[model samples]
Target: MILCDIGNTYIHFCDKYRIWKNLPTNIDKKNLQADIYYISVNPENEKKLLKAHKNSYNIAKIIELDTPYEGLGVDRKAACLGIDDGVIVDAGSAITIDIMHAGRHRGGYILPGLASYFRAYKQISPALDKQINFGISLDEIPLDTQTAISFGTLKSIVSCIKETIGGKKAYFTGGDGKFLAKFFEQSIYNEMLVFNGMQLSIERALKKYEEKK
Candidate 1:
């Protein structure tokens, strides 16, 4: 199965291409074939993807997430569905922390990603311009300049999570989640959590389909 997270910055595709973000049109199905295609993309990309896949794969199915809450991130919603409670920290191109309490999703936070933070620092000023690695922790923050900018910023997020929802379960996902795992020991690595949720959604939808039969 192929699961694609059609994100704002990049489309995350899980096929034979493990970490590669994008794929060329020439790629053969046997090389990177998919049983089902699960996606949460906007209408704009949806049209293009549908048109592209129309003639190629007879077995693939694509789904776009629709909920009562308009403009919600499908990634965040999927993460919330995966975990038991507390917060879901998705450290990807965009860092989003979603809070779920007592089995109910209660929304969360979205902010600039690690790269975005560094990019803003580099673009905004000259003296403060420095490349900061995403791997560094609050204590290992090199100089006060980058430390205050990077660690303090990340620490602030950590503080917010501790203060708001400490006791509950924590789920870490996305590209940067594992790197930032030191601070949050309670968290677990769930790379396919979103894809699994997408699969679950398919199951639910199919169940509904059977009722009509």
Candidate 2:
């Protein structure tokens, strides 16, 4: 089985062996196989992806929810999978901080990711539109404006996570997860989270298919 997590900026996927690879949102549809299970944050992209694979399944079609938590994004649901209760942060094109406690999703906060923040700043101050080393520790503040902006934004994200998680463990994913994990002492970085969740979704889907037989 192939599991895919299509976010706004990138597409993360893994084969049955769990080897992961990612590409930009504009993916080539050629050389693709069937038996794909995917979740997408954008509905339009979701439609295009499904149309590309005739035998693929979107987990959204198999799950049902009542009043509360109904219509939640499948990406968020996939992020929160298999965890008893904690925080799930996906720092991608947009940073998402989701909370799950007592086996219930408590919703989350969305903010501009580090790159998004930098891009917005560049739009206003094009003079500073250069690369900055964002992989520095919080304590090691840089004096240069570019590095300062990068570190400041990273610190702000760390602060947000610290404040929101409030002693709870955090599970971090997405392209930036490993980069951001350095700031957190108690965070677990799992690149395959969405794919892991896909496994669960496929199990549920198979069961439903069997029941209808």
Candidate 3:
């Protein structure tokens, strides 16, 4: 079986052996002949995939998460499903930090991602446009302008996440997940977290179907 997580920019696919991604326009039915279970945040991409694959199932419909947060994105819900007691952090185009305990979502917040911060700085002033130095130390004050900006942005996010977690384990995923996970003492970097959640949802749906039959 194939599991797909369609984002705004890329369509990620995971099979039993490996994972890969393709642009929505680049997807070929010849490469994806197996049954696909998917969750999508991009409606246009979702429609394209649905049209191409007759065996595809949208697992978002089958997933049932215990969260009261209104208009929670399907991707966020999927990332939180696999963790019963931990802070889930997905550091993609946007950073989403969610707290889950006892199989229920307590609350969460969103923050500008690494790229977003860079963009914001660039918009404010061309001189302030600098890429984030992911390796910059948060312990000492920065002297250079680039370091100063990086320190400020990284420190704010790291400190907030640390405080919010309150010593709970953190589960990090997405493009920049590993970079952010390094700041936490108790954290895991799992690239396949959303896929794991999708697999769980698929299994649950299949079991329900069989029971009904």
Candidate 4:
């Protein structure tokens, strides 16, 4: 199956069925034999993806995951797949920390991404906000507001991880993985964490689909 984990900008996956990233407008579906499409995206964005793919004329079967956790963000669930009995920190446009143990998912928190917070403050008061070029020096105490904001954000998440998961194995992913990993006492960063989860989701979905048949 072709498992796709589409984020804000990039689409990550393991295309075992050879589904092209740039799908053609008139694809011969027979050439691509993906058993299922595990889609975990926001509804509006998901619709946009479908429309874009529909333009290609070949539509893979889609399983939009939305329910039980109505306001749940798909990224968190996908991140959870990266670890067993561990905490996941996805630092991107939104800082997401999802905790998972065994095969069950324990919900996590979300904080404004550094950019989001800066943009928000920029709008609130131009004097207080500035362009944040890089991460806070996690090694040293924050000396300025930008660094303070950076430290505060990272600290909040780190505190959350320690408080919630205790000493579970930590796996960090997302664009800001390295920035956050520096402050952590122990953690592993794999940018392809979501892709791993996507594959696992595909496997589970296919198993269930086959059982029903």
Candidate 5:
């Protein structure tokens, strides 16, 4: 089976053997043979994919997660579904931090991603426009401008995450997941974390479908 996570910018596809990404418009031309189980944040792209693949199933319609946060993004839900207990951080265009314990979502928050932070700095002033110094030591006071900006941004995020999780394990995913995961000693970086949740949701959905048959 094929599992797809469609975002505004790209469609991430995962099969048993491999994973890949492509433009939303190009998905129809891939000629995939397996049924697709997907969760999408882009409705227009979702409609296009549904029309193109008759066998596609939207996991959003099938999986019911325990959460009180109204209108939580499906991508966040899918990431949280894979674990019973931990802090889940998806570092994509935006960073989402969620707390899940014993199969239930406690709550979560969102922060501007690394790129967004840099863009915001650029908007403030050209002098402030700089890339994040991922290697900067957060424990030391930065003497340089670049290090100052990086420390301020990365330190705030890391501190907040550490406080929120309170020593629990962290599960990181998405584009910058590995980078952020490095800051946490008790963290696991899995690129396929969302897909793993999608797989589990698909299994539950299939069982429900069979029961109603």
Candidate 6:
């Protein structure tokens, strides 16, 4: 199985073995042999992916996960699928903090990701843009305006997550998840959480198929 988490910035893929790889969302598609399970947040990229798949294979089916949250992305559904109660923090182009309690999604908060924040800061203040880089030590105090922005943004995000989670399990994922994980003592990092959710969805679909027969 090939599971694809197609977001605005990157397309995260995992094969049956659970090896994950990522590519720019705008990249041209290549051929795929296995069954494709995908969750795409970008409509334009989704269209491109579907068109490319149509031209590539005949036997493999493309399955899109059905999300329960009205406006939540499929990747979030995948992250929280097996959990009866927990908080999911995905740090990519944006940071999403979603809660699942007693099988119900309690919604989440969306904020600019670290890189996105830095990029926006630079764009807004091009004079300081060249000086500010997102790669700063978590323990380091801000020595300059650029460092202050980077550290301050990260601390703000971490503080928010800490307050919301309380004592519940937390799952951290996405491009910058590992970095953010350092701030949380209990947060577990799962790069394949979304793929696992896809697999769970497949199992449910299969069970439904069997019941109909």
Candidate whose lDDT is highest: 3
TM-score of each candidate? 0.76, 0.85, 0.92, 0.68, 0.90, 0.83
Candidate 3: give the clashing pairs: none
Residue 50, candidate 4: Cα error in Å is 2.5
For model 5 the local lDDT of residue 55 reads 91
Screening candidate 6 with a backbone cut-off below 3 angstroms (N, C-alpha, C), the clashing residue pairs are none
In Å, residue 176's CA in model 4 sits off its true spot by 1.8
Q: lDDT of all the models against the reference?
A: 0.62, 0.74, 0.89, 0.61, 0.87, 0.73
Q: Rank the candidates by TM-score, best first.
A: 3, 5, 2, 6, 1, 4
Residue 80, model 3: lDDT of: 94
Flag regions of model 1 displaced more than 4 Å. 15-20, 23-31, 41-52, 55-70, 134-137, 140-144
Residue-level lDDT tens digits of model 6 in 136-166: 8767787888778767777788888999989
| Superposition error at 138 for model 3 (Å) | 0.6
Candidate that scores best on TM-score? 3
lDDT of 2 by residue, 124-153 (tens): 787878675766667886888877777778
Question: What would the TM-score be for candidate 2 when compared with the true structure?
Answer: 0.85
Q: Flag the better candidate by lDDT, 2 or 6.
A: 2
lDDT of 4 at 144: 76
Rank candidates, lDDT, best first.
3, 5, 2, 6, 1, 4
Candidate 1's TM-score reads: 0.76
Over 1-213, each residue of candidate 5 has an lDDT whose tens digit, in order, gives 889999877888898859888777887556468998889999998887887788988778765679999999989988998689999999988889999999899999999888888888889999998888889998899999899999988998889888987879999999888999998999999999889888888899889889999
Q: Which residue pairs collide in model 2, if any?
A: none
Error of 2 at 63 (Å): 4.4
C-alpha RMSD for every candidate: 4.2, 2.7, 1.7, 5.6, 2.1, 3.7
